[model samples]
Target: MRKIIAQLFISLDGVVEAPDQWHFPYFNDEMGVAVDSVLGRADTLILGRRTYDSFAGAWPEREAAGGEDAPFAKILGDARKIVVSRQQLEFTWRNSELIKGDLVEAVTALKKEPGDSAIAMSGSVSVVRQLLAAGLLDQLQLLVHPIAVRKGMRLFDEGDAPIPLKLLSSETFETGVLHLFYAPAEQAGEGTYEDAKAHLPQDER
Candidate 1:
């Protein structure tokens, strides 16, 4: 199964929306580099309806507007994306599909499908929450911004169990952001994962 990895940008106070600004100037060199790095790590894309709508209006025309090199625009133009939407709609971006189904089931099927690259979640808080709650996420990459918003949507919603994470790596950017990589902690004295799997029931592991 392809691991579903979530790469998110968040503020110190847990705001996922508009870390650059609430209204405009959404791109920055720091954000661009971060996204480009993550894109190199995955192939499949999944997004919620709101994020899809927002992206559809922006990326296709971005090249003509001299923004094709933008991290999202470049990837959206090429990567295979499953846009989770109930309403049927034609996609403006190339290599995109509109998936209208239960988010968890649909994502689960996608992960099960044979693929070389890992799946990734971007810009969609609702979809990210669903993946995290379902225990579908294999790794988390967070670029933590220093700003604190009074109120806004966040990356992780309620009902998230305290699944322990082992810190894999951490680095700071010139913008004062911290890039943290985390994966589920390996149990102490645990043998190879295959050996561990044989001992624990599939569901428990």
Candidate 2:
């Protein structure tokens, strides 16, 4: 089965919106490698309407201009893009299509389809949240920048049910950005303070 990975550039305060406003300052070669690693594993891209709109508006133009960003734009252009939205939309970009039927069911089917590469979802907070809640997201990769925007749409919102996660791996870049990879896990154990005392530091104990 192909894995469904959700990759996002998030702030230390958990904000996932408008990375263009704050993310560029911290971009480095390490970050580029990290981003490329994720994109390299995925042949298909799943995007929410908002993210799709934003990408469609920019990447194609960048590809046409043929500059430093053109290679990256071409990567996006060549990949099969699945746009998820309730309203109808005319897909102007090549290899783009609208998702059919229920979102969960459609995605579940996509995972089962024969494919060597994984399916990637980037910059679609709502789509990522829905997939996470449905237990369809196989991996959640976060590039955690060391800054707090204080105000923006965050990955996790209030009143959400607790979703346990297991850390698969992590890395720290020279820029102080943390690359965290996580997978869904069983519910975390609940223990009393006395039950946890055995794991406390010696000084604290």
Candidate 3:
């Protein structure tokens, strides 16, 4: 089964929107390697309507310009893109297709397909959240920056049901950005204040 991975560039306050505005100041070779590692494993890209539009408008142009970003742009342009949207859209980008039928069903079927490579969802916060809630997301990879944006569209919204995740691995970059990889877990462990006191210093206890 192909793993469905959701990769995001998030802020300290959990904001995932507008990475371009605050994301690059901390960029380094380590972060580049981490991002490329995730992209290298995925042959298919799933995106929300907004993210799809944004990429469609920019990456193709960048590819044509043959700039420093062109190589990465070509990767995005060549990958099979599945766009999720309720309303109809005209797909101008090559190898792009709108998702058919129910979102969960479509993604479930995609996961069952024969493939060793991964299916990656990048920058589509809503789609990621939906898939995570439906128990379809296999891995959640986050590059958490040290700064707080304070206001923007966050990954999790208010009143959302609690979802438990287990850390698979983690690494810290010199820029103070944390690369965290997580997978869904059965349930979150519970403990009381008195239970926590067991590990406290003798004087504090």
Tell me, by TM-score, which candidate is best: 2
How high is the CA lDDT of each candidate model? 0.74, 0.93, 0.92
1 or 3, greater by TM-score? 3
Error of 1 at 65 (Å): 3.4
Per-residue lDDT tens digits for candidate 2, residues 1-205, read 8999888999999999999999999999999998888775578999999999999999999999999999999999999999999999999999999999999999999999999888998999999988999999999999999999999999997755888999999999999999999999999878898988988778844
Off by over 4 Å in 1: 20-30, 66-72, 185-205
lDDT minimum window of 10 residues, candidate 1: 18-27
**Candidate 1 TM-score over all chains jointly:** 0.76
The deviation in Å at residue 178 for candidate 2 is 0.3
**Which candidate model has the greater lDDT, 1 or 2?**
2
Cα lDDT tens digits for candidate 3, 41-134: 5789999999999989999999999999898888888889999999998889999999999999999999999988899888999999899999
| TM-score: model 3 vs. ground truth | 0.94
